[model samples]
Target: MSRTPDNWLLKVTGLTKIYGEPNENTLALTGPQFGSNICPETESIVACADINFELYPGEVLGIVGESGSGKSTVVKMLYFDIEKTYGEALLKPYANAGVNTLDESNQKKRYIRNHLMGMVYQNPRDGLNFNFTSGGNIAEKLIMAGNYHVGGIRERASELLVKTEVPVLRMDDRPSNFSGGMQQRVQISKAIANNPPLLFLDEVTTGLDVSVQAKVLDLIRELQHELGIAMIVVSHDLSVIRMLTDRTMVMKNGRIVESGLTDQILQDPQHAYSQLLVSSLL
Candidate 1:
């Protein structure tokens, strides 16, 4: 998809996440060049640094890297699951894209998360309430976004379940009773319950069986096409990235080493790290 400044749904600049106290040279000392995110000077961990990107509406952007490559950290910071040490992210639908979402107050951040964004984690437990029925989990998301009509909530929940290929008969069962794949489907349904423009998926199919993974990925593709929801998909699996994303960002040791059209990256990766990844995928 063609992306212009005015057409971007989300703009992120200089996004950095570091753990522990760090001095001025922390970021400089850690990255792909050093082959480590750990700063020798201050012992701080740079989960990600100087990340910049623009996600257009209805576009699927992929962050592909191996474990510890900081792909997940980027999305976690944007989703407010973790704090950013430095950076700014602006969502066009919020504050006319003038305010940095990372700087927003907690209450306002929650409001943005509830209404403008959604997340589906690799582990369903992190995203779903096992104690609640599958339908109830979706209900919680809807209710938080100000949906109070019980009948409407149920109707929407069932609709989402069916849309995601989850049997409506299982709606009343708790996540604990569902298979891993089923749990993920429920997680996805809840994530999109509010029809958020932006969604984040972090290694969502990592542990599923191969057949199950394909099903989940297919469902996700269907949802994206049907809802026109833009997504930031973080995955170590190149296949997952290849299957879902429009554009791709290759991360390694806390920095984006390469980024461009997914097909271009796959066919002719410029960065050595990215080349290694694409070659492995082939």
Candidate 2:
């Protein structure tokens, strides 16, 4: 995914994650590890291995595969939710002189997560502050991004809610009262609170009814177009990928099997797994 950088917001290469310790016979492992801390019964679980991709500003990249394909793991690593065992990712803005995010200080990583990146998990609970008011939820992010004025925060929060198609009057209510679709919208509103440069959506519409899923997906498309945010969307459903992504990557058993323009890959998948996925969709 790394060539010449022309307005690319992110460049990731060799991003990897393996649960548990390396196999006893493996020669080496990357990154820090306490070999003794691993559970004796656990063998290493390679969730995602050697993932490489890039995102141009405002482009939507989709990762699609059946469950346990390591698609979610890839996004989690980029979001810093899962520690990568090896590999480096570069966010162009912060990667001056080759600053690899996998090696960045925790403080800097936190700053990037709070200010430059936003995420919408399939479950609203993962992205939303369940206890906080809808408006307050967005304000939490704004506050972290260094916005201090209450009035400005409230205004922005309200704007985002309306933009995401949530009723402004419900801003004071907690997300616990919202329906599945409403909760996802509220989470979407909170994610874009700071107008972040990069956004991550992991199965954003996985469990919703068809109608509700369409609404959530539409809102995502609208937000991406309006905000011009580079985004990585991870979903097991190819339909979801087709609906929103510019480029798509197919994964299986912790590795990328195919990647290309969304339509091309969907219509003429090269990898055996990708072909099977497309056939199943039909």
Candidate 3:
């Protein structure tokens, strides 16, 4: 595994968001701002607010919470899927320069996505191009990152497919022909095609069967360690957090209620909401 020597690969601070017209959105106050008391009928709803975290190279960080806890929103903002109302993130290679992704141009962001990071979504369709063959999907990422040789692209696709436990012979099949689990595996293969240093998994196992979920999670665990990549895993399942992440942050109503080692948070939750969440999982 080739790893950068950076202490913090990713650092986030004061991540916040609000939806709707400006002044109409409940006076636009900054939030510690986990959740809002103002009725949505009043106008603005806070999706996530004042969020902060630091991710070290080769470290796995888990953001776990119930639906609507703002976990997904944070990742969406980071990956540039949606615009953030406000926030800052500094990533390595760019760390010393302290570049916030939100401040980067679209072209630079595109370059970063293709060469520096990877993302796997819960819905395979969001990540996979159903019309493209499995190998083609992976090749797309490589091409965008500037690889041009057909032979090299195909060879790398086969390597990644095998690594992800997908059959190499199935490389030419379109994702539309795959089962949900297989499609997700293909997506994972594509995400890591560039051997990106940072990865994001958002609700990856949400719709898989239990056995399939286990295998997919195992693949993720093995690949992360093998590649020495830093990752942010977003899930509502605490079990997923326990199995994959080194540290866990418990979020509620769009705010992180508690953050600590996974074992510590699960075994000795301090926040009322976190306690309720853990107990409910019992």
lDDT of each residue in 68-167, candidate 2, tens digit only? 7788888888888878999989887775527888787788888889988999998999998888999999999999889999999999998999999999
Candidate 3 off by > 4 Å = 1-6, 22-41, 95-97
RMSD of every candidate to native, in Å, equals: 0.8, 4.7, 2.8
Q: Each model's C-alpha lDDT?
A: 0.95, 0.84, 0.86
Which is better, 1 or 3, measured by lDDT?
Answer: 1
State the lDDT of candidate 3 residue by residue for 208-270, as single tens digits. Answer: 999999999999999987898899999999899989998899887677879998889889999
Which candidate number would show the highest TM-score if scored against the true structure? 1
Give the TM-score of each candidate.
0.98, 0.91, 0.92
> Who is ahead in TM-score, 2 or 3?
3
Candidate 3, residue 126: Cα displacement in angstroms equals: 0.5
lDDT of 3 at 125: 94
1-282, model 1: which lDDT tens digit per residue?
566658999999999989999999998899999999999998999999999999999999999998999999999999999889999999999999999999999999999999999999999999999999999999999999999999999999999999988999989999999899999999999999999999999999999999999999999999999899999999999999999999999999999999999999999999999989988877
User: Where in model 2 is the C-alpha error above 4 Å?
Assistant: 1-5, 24-42, 95-97
Worst 10 residues of 1 by lDDT: 1-10
lDDT of 2: 0.84
Q: What is the alpha-carbon RMSD of candidate 3 to the true structure?
A: 2.8
